[model samples]
Target: MVIEENECILLQHRTDEDNWCIPGGVMEIGETFEETVKRETFEETGLEVNGLELFGIYSGESCFVQ
Candidate 1:
């Protein structure tokens, strides 16, 4: 999500599910995770990002699977 200087995040409202979520999507073919992040961010929020770093990786049963 694109967080502004005020610490507000860019969230998408899902009409089908009636929920709000951070902008993200599945990784495309031959695309790296960082590339997917950049593309999804732009596609959803119309913003470009740089200087990405490792934050955390979630797995296990509780995590969503594509």
Candidate 2:
């Protein structure tokens, strides 16, 4: 999910690790990609979001999996 305001983007500061990244998480069972985005964004940032659009898709071994 991309949250842009005034040309700035939203990023999450991770508490468990020393890094800043875009807010996201693993998809729950039976959840679509968009649902996962909405759920994770709210879980991480307390924001309720809609009007989702595809930003990109990544695959292959270099992608993170959990």
Best by TM-score: 2
Candidate 2, residues 3-31: lDDT per residue as tens digits? Answer: 87799989999989979998887777899
Clashing pairs in 2: none
Residue 11 CA displacement from its true place in model 1, Å = 1.4
- Which 10 successive residues of model 2 have the least lDDT summed? 57-66
* Alpha carbon deviation, residue 5, candidate 2 (Å): 2.4
- Once model 2 is optimally superposed onto the true structure by TM-score, how far is the C-alpha of residue 2 displaced, in angstroms? 2.2
Model 1, 1-66: lDDT tens per residue?
Answer: 444457776788877889998877766789987898899988877888887765655556776567
Q: Would you estimate the TM-scores of all the predictions?
A: 0.66, 0.81
Clashes of 1: 0
